[model samples]
Target: MEAIDGLIHGFGVAFQLQNFAACLAGVFIGNVVGVLPGLGVMTAISMLLPLTFAMPPVAAILMLAGIYYGAQYGGAICSILLNLPCHPPHAVTCLDGYPLTLKGKGGTALGVTMLASFLGASFGIVLMVFFAPYLVRIALNFGPAEISSLMLLGLLAGSTLARGSKLKGMSMTCLGLLLGTMGTDINTGLQRFTFGFPELDDGLEIVALALGLFGVAEFLKSVNAVAPVSTSATRIRIADLWPSRSELRTAIVPALRGTLVGSLCSMIPGTGPTIASFMAYGLEKRVSRRPQEFGHGAIQGVAAPEAATHAAVQGDFIPTMSLGIPGDAVMALLLGALVIQGITPGPQLITEHPDIFWGLIASFWIGNILLMVMNMPMIGLWVKLLSIPYRYLYPSALFFVCIGVYSVRSDMFSVGTTLAIGVFGHVLLRHGFHPAPILLGFVLGQRFEENLRRALLLARGDLSIFVTRPISLAFLLTAVLLLGAQLYFALRRRDEIQLPPSASPILDE
Candidate 1:
């Protein structure tokens, strides 16, 4: 009864004239962004966050949240119809989905993909419905000691997720943390590393840092990077969106497995949909009877990754809401947006802002339904999006980054910082470094320091305070275990080697 009443209240809030319209607009924009390449949820949400100045905070957050998860339903449209992946999460879909198209089963692929995605998302929503609030209640009681320990775990997990040498990833993490602290001291009324520049007083604009690190760095990589000219995407048709009986059966187990894998993996900070989907697909392939069929248009292949994408997207929101730790870049941007709106997304969010919490959660399912209806009709549009020439697209992507970053700070310094970080990020990439973990570190580093200092202050400068607190001890133990596992795995693994993208798609081929 209580849940129903709360849900009714949510419906009352969400179904209002302007709020409903915002929901539709958000779903529409989400599909557009998800269908297009290079424009990630973070960039899209950050770019649009400024436009929310005149809108209600709830409505603005509702729309941005839609863009974040609606992509779970829409991104595969391009990956299946066009060989080009819409994003990293959908990259695995390109493996079997495109080949399924070649086999004249494009309709089956699209249908099953949509169904699997819906199921996975629904599973995550169920988890959110029952579990999220309890988690929130527990987290709401956390002290600075506990918060700091959580951040430590987050950084360690992020470092573990990076693809390069752990040391190099840690180096980048240190660099990001140092950069994160470049402006003002949060504790004292003093400036730490501003170099007497007023612009540095506000710290590095997150939009600039992320855009430079992920977006601009991506553009720089493409300057001379090989572009495969192919004509494989023009074969899309509406008939490709329906699933057959056998195909549906084939998708069931894989979808279920993928959902379980993705939802579980999502709880671990920094494990985004891309890695979750890939692991789910790998697990399915390893356990399948026809392992040989993998990367050769296997139906299970399409189901697992698609399902994982949805589950992971929903699951990633857990840490974001519970602990204020963004799971990935998109979540980071969402966190930033919430901060801008004067709505901190910590444990108190659910209790203090029931309307925002319940409304957003309810809207997720609405957005999922809206996603299917919105994306199915736009398959042709998304196919055309995939058909766009890289030459023209990248420049526009860069321009959007520039405009978005500049809009955040109203200064050219951000643009310059973006370019500099981008170039430096590119150079680091070439020298075998990854920025994703650095982003995680950068996002949590300040809070980690604050919490650590607070815990120390409370303990009267005793280092043993970490072990004195039960939650802190648990996190420390987990970190030690994680580091131990990483060492064991790294030692047992084969020599490091780079694999080409062409070969990458079919590593399990």
Candidate 2:
């Protein structure tokens, strides 16, 4: 009943002209962003963050949220038609999507992808509708100790679960924490890590860091890299778009399973849409009787991963909104946006600012519908986007990055900082180090530190305070177990690698 009432109130807010326009603009840009190779949704959102300063908080959030999931709809277009994954989450789609294209069923693959994307997003939205409110209620019981422990768990999970070397991820996370410490200590008036630069007193501008790492750095890395071209992609016809009834029936179970996988992944910190899509594809292959068809134009391959990606993308908001714990880098950026807008995210968010929460949820339904309608009719246009030269795209995108960073403080220092970080980020990218974990660490580090300080203060510096509280102890234990499991797996794998060939049953066989 509450959910129903909230939805009704939400629709009233979403229908407002300004908010509606923001959602439309966001989804449209997101679609284009997703169709363009090398430009991620994170980069797009980061670049646009400064622009939201003048907008209403609810509308700003609606727009940014639109971009995140709307990208899911457009990503498969490139993956299916041109064998390119504009979005990382859709990379798995390229396996079967491109094969179907080669077999002249690219339209069919796209149709299935679209259907799966819609269904997956719908499922995620429904889950959030009923789940987030209850989560908020449970979180209201948490105290400083529990909050701090939970934050520690989030940091650890994000670092370890990010897509890279766990050691490197942890190192980057520590680096982020160090960066977060650059500003004056909240409790103490003394400054640290300023290095005598007055600009450092306020700490690093998130706009600079986000734009530098995700936007400018990506542009620098992808500037010279060439994308594979597909001539047949230009020939897609509306008539060839729909799959047969049998294929639709075949896709239903996998799509549902993928949605389930994505929803579950969303609840776990650090795992996001990209992981969900890959896991879904793997699951589908294992369950299929004709597993051999998986990479050879399997409809299940197109459906499952696309479904999972959309589902996970939408579900990613649950943790961010309900617990104030961002599940991934993108969600962290969104959280920053909320902070900038003066809207605190957490259990009290639903009560204090129900408009932002419910309105954003309502916008999801509206945006997804718009995406579905726009994508099907405009498939040809998106395919044509593949023909656009990288030279034209990267430079244009960098221009916006520079402008956005500069706009934040109207200072050249921010632009220079962005460039410096971009160069460093490019170096990291070259060495196979992901910058996402860094952003996660940087965003969550402050909250962790603050909560830890408060918790200690409440306990009069007693370390046992954490363990005395069952919830706090549980979170700490989870963090420890996560690290232990990763260590155990690492050592086990190393041992297996070092075993003598004669001692292996596989070698004897």
Candidate 3:
């Protein structure tokens, strides 16, 4: 009954004219940004965050949340039509989507993507509505030791699961933690890594770092890439938009499976949509009767990953809102936005600010509905956008990146910091180091340190308090188990590779 009443109140708040306008504008901008390469939700949000400083908290959050999820809807458009992914999660869609486009079934593939995305987002939102409150209740029982342990687990999971070498990921995470330690110490009044800069008192600006690492770094990469040339004229007619009954049937089960996978993965901090989408695609391929059809335009291939990506993104809000733990870098930015608005996110957020929490939830549904309605009709528009040359697009994006970072503090130092970070990020990219784990580490580092100190203080400087608390102990054990499993699999793979090839003994046997 309490949840029901809260939702009803949320509906009332979301239905307000100003909030509705904000939602519409946010989704519209998000969709447009998602259609364009070299610009993503993180960049868009970072650029627009300063503009939201004067708005009401609910209205500000509603808009930013819209952009975050609406981009998922838009990302699929380019992946299916142009073989170009606007976001990392959409990259999986390109494997099957482009092949389908080449087969002259682009319209069918896109239609399936739209349907799957809608269904996936709906499933995730429903899960969030039910599970977030329970999670918050459980989190309310947690003290500093448990919270610190949980954050450590999140960091370990992120580093271990990130693509490429775990060592590199761990290294990046450590770097991020080091960077996070800059500026004034929370417990003590002294500065740690300020390097004598007065601007470093508040710590490194998150807006500057985000714009540099993601926004500017992405722009630099795009600038060096060859502009795609469209030689053949691909016309998608309205008549070709509807999927055949058989195709629709083929996509249903995979979409459901993807939704389930995505919803579950989203609850885990540091796991994002890209992992969910890839996992969904891999699962579908493994279980299908014709695994060979995956890269060759399988409808299930298009449906599953697209669904999972959207669902995973929506599911991320669960941890971000309920436990004040961001699932990924994008969610970290959202968390920062909340703090900037003077609203703290945690277990008490719901009770203290029901309007913000419930209103944001209600707005998510509205934003998804708006995305579904906007996607199909605007297909032609988005497809047209793909034809525009990169040379034209990147410059405008770079301009925004510079201005956004500068506006954060009305200082040139932030812009210079963005440039430096962008160069460093480019170097990192060249060396196969992913920026996600680093960003997550930086975002959570402060909280982890704070809680660690608090826990020790509470326990009279005894480290055993972490092991003595049941919740903290459980989280640490889970982290150990996960790390052990990863190591075991890695060693097994190495052993398999080192083993000598079987000789003619098999033939003799």
Candidate 4:
């Protein structure tokens, strides 16, 4: 009943002219952004954040939210048509999507992806509507100690579970925590790590950091990479875009299974759409009678991952909104945007500003419908978008990166800061380190520190406070278990590598 009433109020808010227009514009831009290879949702949102300073909080948030999920719909286009996964989450789609294109069933694959994406997103949105309100109620009971312990769990899980070497992810996370400490200390009013620079008092701009690491760093790496060429695959007919009844029957079950996998992954920290999509694809292949057809244009291959990506993308919002704990870099930026708007996320946010909370939820239904329309009838328009040359696209994007950075403080120094960070980020990429964990750590570190200090002060400086409370103790134990399991796996894999070839079980087989 509470959800129903809140949703009713939310629809009223969402129906306003400004909010409606914002949602439309955001989805449209996100569609274009996703179709482009180098420009990711992170870059699009970071660049556009400054521009939303004057917009109403509800409208701004609605627009930004649209971009996040809207990109999911657009991401499948290039993967199926050009064998290019512009978004990392869509990379799994290329395994089967491109194969479908080679077999001249690209349009059919896209039809399945569209159906799966809608079904997946709808399932995720319904989960949020029912789950987030209850989650917020439970989170309200968490004291500083519990919150601190939970955040520690989030940090550790994010680092260890990220798609890379655990050691490297941990290193990047530590670096971000160090960066988070650079600004003035709120409790003591004493500056730390400012290096005598006045701007460091505010620490690095979130916009600058996000644009530098994701936006400019990706640009630097992709600048020299060859652009995908158009082939006969681009000549897909509109009539072929609709799947046959047989193909639809083949896709339905896998799409549902993928949605379930995605919803589960969304609830877990550090496991985002990229991981979920791959997991769904692997799961489908394992369960299928025709596993041999997985990489060679299986319809299940196209349906499962695409559904998982959409479901996970929508489900990512639940933790960010209810717990105020972002699951990934993209969610971190959205959290930052809310903070900038003077709207604190977490349990209090839903109660204090029900309009923003429910309105955002309502807008999801609207945005996803709009995305379906655009992806279907306008498929040709996006196919044409693939022909854009990299040379013209990147330089133009870099110019906007600089401009967006400059717009924040009206200073050239911020722009320079972005480029410097970008250069370093590119260096990290070259060395096989991901910058995503860095953003997650940076965003969560200050909150963790603040809660730790508060819990310590309340407990009269006793470190045992974290273990005394049952919730806090449970969270700590979970983090320990997670870390231990990861280390055990790492060691087991290492030992397997060290085994002599003749002594290996495979040799006996």
Q: How close is each model in CA RMSD to the real structure?
A: 3.7, 1.9, 2.9, 1.8
Question: Would you give me the overall lDDT of model 3?
Answer: 0.86
lDDT of 3 by residue, 1-509 (tens): 67778788998999999899899999998898888777878879878877788789999999999998888888887888888887889999999998999999999998899889889998988887788899899999999999999989988887887778887888888888888999999988899999899999999888888777887877777677746746255667666778999999999999999999899889777679989999999899989999888898999999999889889988999988988888888898898888888888889899999999999888888888888788767777777876688878788878878877777789999999989998998888888887767777888889889999999999999999999999999999999998898899899778877766772222321
**lDDT, candidates in the order shown:** 0.79, 0.90, 0.86, 0.90
> In candidate 4, which residue pairs get closer than 3 Å at backbone N, Cα or C atoms, i.e. clash?
none
Summarize candidate 4's per-residue lDDT along 27-98 as a digit string, tens digits. 999998888888889989988988888899999999998999988888899988888889889999999999
- What are the runs in model 2 whose C-alpha is more than 4 Å off? 228-233, 499-509
Clashes of 1: 1
lDDT of 2 at 234: 57
Work out the TM-score per prediction.
Answer: 0.91, 0.97, 0.94, 0.97
The residue-by-residue lDDT of candidate 1 on 1-509, one tens digit each, is 55566667777888877777788888788877787666666557656666765588789878888888876666787787667686788889998998988888877898898889889998987777777777887887788888887887877777776555887767777877787787788888688788888888878777677777778776677656635335454565667678877778889999999999999988987778988999999899889999989888999999999898899898888888767987776777777777777888888887788888778777878888887776677676766665567788778878777877777768898789889988998888787887766666666777778888998999999988888889878988998898898888786553333545564433435
Reference-based TM-score, model 2: 0.97
Question: What clash pairs does model 3 have?
Answer: none
**Which segments of model 1 are wrong by more than 4 Å?**
1-4, 223-233, 494-509
Displacement of the residue 55 alpha carbon in candidate 4, Å? 1.4
Number of the candidate with higher lDDT, 1 or 3: 3
